[model samples]
Target chain A: MSAAPILAAFRQAFAEAWAGGAGALLPLGFLGGTAVLVPLGIGSDTDTLSAVGPGIIWVSLALSSLVTLERIFQADVEDGTLDLWLQTGAPMAGIAAAKTLAHWLAAGLPLALASPLLALMFQAQASLELLVHLGLYALGGLAFFFWGGVGAALSATVRRGGLLISIIALPLYVPTAIFGALAMTGGIGSDGAPMLLAASTLFACAVAPYAMAAALRLAAD
Target chain B: MFAGQGEQAKPLPVTLLTAPLLTARDLAILRGERVLFRGVGLSLSPGEGIVLRGANGAGKTTLLRMLAGLTRPEAGDVARAAPHHWIGHKEGIKPQESPRGHLALWAQAWGSKANIPEILEKMALKRAADVPGRYLSAGQRRRTAFGRLLLEERPVWLLDEPYTALDASGKAMLDAVISSHLRSNGAIIASMHDIAGFPVTAEVTL
Candidate 1:
């Protein structure tokens, strides 16, 4: 039940995934394509990626998070390593917590940190404005891992459902995208509404772990 | 040269007790819409031994898993003492890991120090200690699995097809190990195709 063993397990899981080319290539490729193509799509005086940059960033973060789910149980399960994990005297809740934390660090944290460059490519206006958008993107990215955990757990037992995860996960991500989009483009209609959007992001983060754990137990069954 | 340390362990003899070490009443196993076994009743007390015999695909693995607490029964009672040692038929040892490391992991799980050299020497696995488990021959891998059983402290042992890759000497070692365990008054339920090694314990066939 302690945090240490679970954390250690998570680190080991994450490291193995990283060494094995853990998710991000597909999403990164898609984003890179959008970065190049979106500017071409908007041929008018209105810039391209700038107009669509935030949206693409949001989608890419979601995709990236989704891709990482493929690695959650693949290697361990294949190698019979998970037998030991499941047999350990520890509770599942702690295991879920550690897994989510590692997923966020490996998958979400880097995506968020790189959001500013994406924002700049879109020809965003001011540094402060770009920072706000990037900040919002970062929060949104962090929030996605919880959903990803749930998705990963849902797919844990299945052999090849990792790619199908977007179908299972995209619905839960709608609210975050909506609130995040509003926060990004200065679309807050009323006073204190932006704060509400930020609050929702935090709320998603809080609720993710429990839901993911439940999904994992169900998947395991 | 292997001496009294047998290849396949004898079901260690444990003190006889009224409380059964392993019990299942009306137990049933269903795997993926297939009923493996139904109304299986079994009980093994200390110093008792039973051989699980049936045709292939007769739910031997499923029943073993159910008994090991790795799988749940669909009906009836399947109860056991906590922390009993179980070795399935699949050579469940991790292939990429070294023999020594696998023993260490087994030790960790069963609460015993691996004493790797002693185990390797006893099992004729000393030469393969540093080799990956996958690289070993079938008999060698089975030997590796037997090495893990050496560290088992529990009174109840559930072994499935443990004779799979053993040689003449290896088979003798197994017989000796089972004898030693029986001598210690431990209870054993082993699913095996051959019954030449264990002579004293009562045999139950399903």
Candidate 2:
């Protein structure tokens, strides 16, 4: 298959993420804000902070990714890009996958890159463990974005569907969040949790594109 | 009409080459949980134009969407020889995108290598090519949307209310383009309140 259409879609989506400025950086700021506020909400004790730091980072990462999901496909639908996509006769799944991947690159990746700083703030060791968690955060962030993309496509036609997207996507995020938190905290039964975290992301990679494609088709109809 | 080709060697074979580009049989559609129209059928051949005329709320847009494969008909089927250019009410123009940038994106997605500068000139949009979509007026945006038609040589064109916001000169320009497109063996199925100064093969009124 020719990759021109998919690549063009990717460029269009990625450009929009930065063109508006708010779209590209709001999630990063949100992630950083949550990382800062969590310590104040509870106590900043080193033991307490270390006990829940990684888990808190994972939760905020997932939530921050959702901040951008509601507009991912909804803007395309509103601006008639979806109809043009249908006319081009390219695989809708490919277009959906490209746009979602662009979203992950724009909104999710920054949060992952900042995870080391967030981890530092939460008293995570400034050592090799931080790098391991950084990698894990990237993978887990991708899973969250893909699953959230399905919800975004499903609600593309609904007005103010941000809440609806969160409702639909949060339940699907359970596996990744649990596995990623366990992998980070090194708690009991966490030996295979890192692999399981990667597996959850792989499963999302396998399934979310087609699900988004079907939902987008319905939205276009 | 066949005799106007001025080919005496093999007129019969030349005539046989013009097969129907689009065909629909007994198409039915609904709007807002109500049956809008049913039993609609039309055939479009090379160089033919089908104009859909009806009052407001007559399902013209729905029928066009069904033919473009954007919406499914409640009944019957549509067969198309190739992909079509569908221009709906929404111009697909992003507020932050310039006319040139919008066309460039479409060209890349449609895999059309047509010259954008030439299309910009043909559409009288050279001056406004670099202006952002939000800065463009309605007529300018409509003209930008029409630029997509020239970016690719598709066999069929399905336009919904294409003349909605065009001025007199813009309408004349569109008429000229429609005539040229018909002369080049391209079929057009458009919904409009009236067909002004353009040759039409048939009219379907609901």
Candidate 3:
């Protein structure tokens, strides 16, 4: 397929992500709220807060990505856009990938950008290196959205699929989450952990689109 | 139109008129545990239209969906010569986007190179063009969905309840659109309870 349709789908999904004005900010708020509560709950011991800061951020990012998964394909399925796409002979996998990319850009990218400030609040010390590491870890956010998208597509037919999507997606997210958290703390020099994280992201990118397309087709049926 | 020089000139109109545009055979559909319809069949040629009439729960929508390839038949096959357009009961308009934006997005997705404004105007959606879809009334939303049929050119149209929520003007616009489409050798399969004013070539009662 040419880049035109894919770009159009991406733009549409991005616009939808920001529709109703507050939809785009929900994830960021969730991230910041989680960050704030973690320090308060764990007591403001600087060492303890810094020690667990990266892990909290990763968890928050995963949860926020999950929060937006239901909207990825459900709305389109409900509104007949998927049927129109199918009839037009557009490749469902390509459309799925484009929407996932849009979700990552609209929701995941913002959370990644905000990680540095949240990390500072947790007393992780706002170092340039830490910021770069958080950015690198952000790449895994795309994997989350793509893989979670598969689950969302699978449950598209279910009237209330939010919980089912979480159940199906969270287990699939374990490996990426583990590798990503490891990379963050183990630093750039850590032997193969960062590489493993990148590999997981690439693997999800490769496999999630086809899985999602199949699931969407089944849901339509 | 003239044929190539010294070549045996083929009559294009006769050839198009003879071939079937869409065909279905002995179709069966089961929703959940109950059978919706069985032994259903239909064939459509260019410039033809079929109206499907059945009481509620008689599977008119399911039959139309099967014919459009949106849903699979339980025990039959559907074949079509060209890509078709489908308009379901749902308007499918995003509440947040304006009618113009929604139509433009669909036009882009369908790879339509036509002028968007002209199509919207033809659908009588010019006044509500900039209004968000959620803000549009039922009739306006249905009109916006119907605008898609004009946005992209296709060989066949499958519409379910095309008259639902349409006022007299909206119904007139729909009739005009359907008439023009048939004039262009386009085929249509519409499921509707009331088929008055529709130029139907055949009828299928379930």
Of the true interface contacts, what fraction does each candidate have? 0.06, 0.59, 0.51
Ranking by lDDT: 2, 3, 1
> lDDT per residue, candidate 1, B104-186, as tens digits?
65554434544778988888888888997668888887787777667645567778887887889999988888777766767
Docking class of 3: acceptable
User: On residues A25-102, what C-alpha lDDT tens digit does candidate 1 reach at each position?
Assistant: 544555566666666767534465566778877877777677667666555555545544554455555666676777
Q: What is the TM-score of each candidate against the true structure?
A: 0.75, 0.95, 0.94
Model 1 chain B lowest lDDT segment of ten: B1-10
lDDT of each: 0.67, 0.87, 0.82
Interface RMSD of each: 8.7, 7.4, 6.3
Candidate 2 local lDDT, B1-206, one digit each (tens):
11112122122245534778789999998778899999999999888989999999999988998898989888999998645788899888877788999999988876677799999999999999999987999999999999998877776889898888999989999889888988877779999996556888899998
Candidate 2 runs further than 4 Å off: B1-16
* Tens digit per residue, CA lDDT, model 3, A72-135: 7889888877776666566778888998898888888888888888888988766787777666
TM-score of the first chain in candidate 3 relative to the native first chain: 0.94
Better structure of 1 and 2 per lDDT: 2
